[model samples]
Target: MFRFIWLSDQRWGQLEPHLPKNQLGARRVNDRRMISGIIYMLRTRCRWCDCPAG
Candidate 1:
């Protein structure tokens, strides 16, 4: 199957600065991956629970 990556490094670099820091809890290590999954689901019109696990 062809893999889809919605966020490129350059795009993520631009976006990363605007995202809020996680100060109150443990830092999330997979924010980019999680956002990519979300974008893939939205673009593909798949159900949230049906999104593939990367």
Candidate 2:
């Protein structure tokens, strides 16, 4: 079975500073979830559409 991966608070803290903020568009919500999904996809070599819902 595949295990879901999530970003830790410390890791997110380190990454939070590098992410774009308050851009001229819709607000970026669920940034951590989005990043975690991307990381999961890359690590598991799974298709984006095949990713399991949280």
Candidate 3:
């Protein structure tokens, strides 16, 4: 079982400004949640297919 890694509010505040905005897409998933999952996967050296579903 892998633990989820969520960004703290302070960290997210710093990161929020750097994310893309107003792109040509229908919509996007929750950036914070997606980023947290990516962080967890990389830190744990887990395969992309093994990453937990949202």
RMSD per model, one decimal: 2.3, 2.4, 1.6
TM-score of every model versus the real structure: 0.72, 0.77, 0.82
Task: Residues 2-46, candidate 3: write the lDDT tens digits.
Answer: 577999999999999999999997798899988887788789898
In candidate 3, stretches whose alpha carbon ends up further than 4 angstroms from where it belongs are: 52-54
Cα error, residue 49 of model 3, in Å, equals 2.1
Give every collision pair in model 1: none
Candidate 3: deviation at residue 34, Å? 0.6
List the candidate numbers ranked by lDDT, top first. 2, 3, 1
lDDT of 2 by residue, 1-54 (tens): 778789999999999999988789876779998998889899989887885676
Put down candidate 1 lDDT per residue, 1-54, tens digits, no spaces. Answer: 747867988999998898778578876767787788778877778787775564
**Deviation (Å) of 29 in candidate 1:** 3.2
**Residue runs of model 1 more than 4 Å from their true location after superposition:** 52-54
What is the number of backbone collisions in each predicted candidate, taken in the order shown?
A: 0, 0, 0
- Between the candidate structures 2 and 3, which one is better when assessed by TM-score? 3
Candidate 2 is scored at a TM of: 0.77
Q: Which stretches of candidate 2 lie over 4 Å from their true place?
A: 52-54
lDDT of 2 at 48: 79
TM-score of 3: 0.82
User: Considering TM-score, where higher is better, how would the candidates rank from best to worst?
Assistant: 3, 2, 1
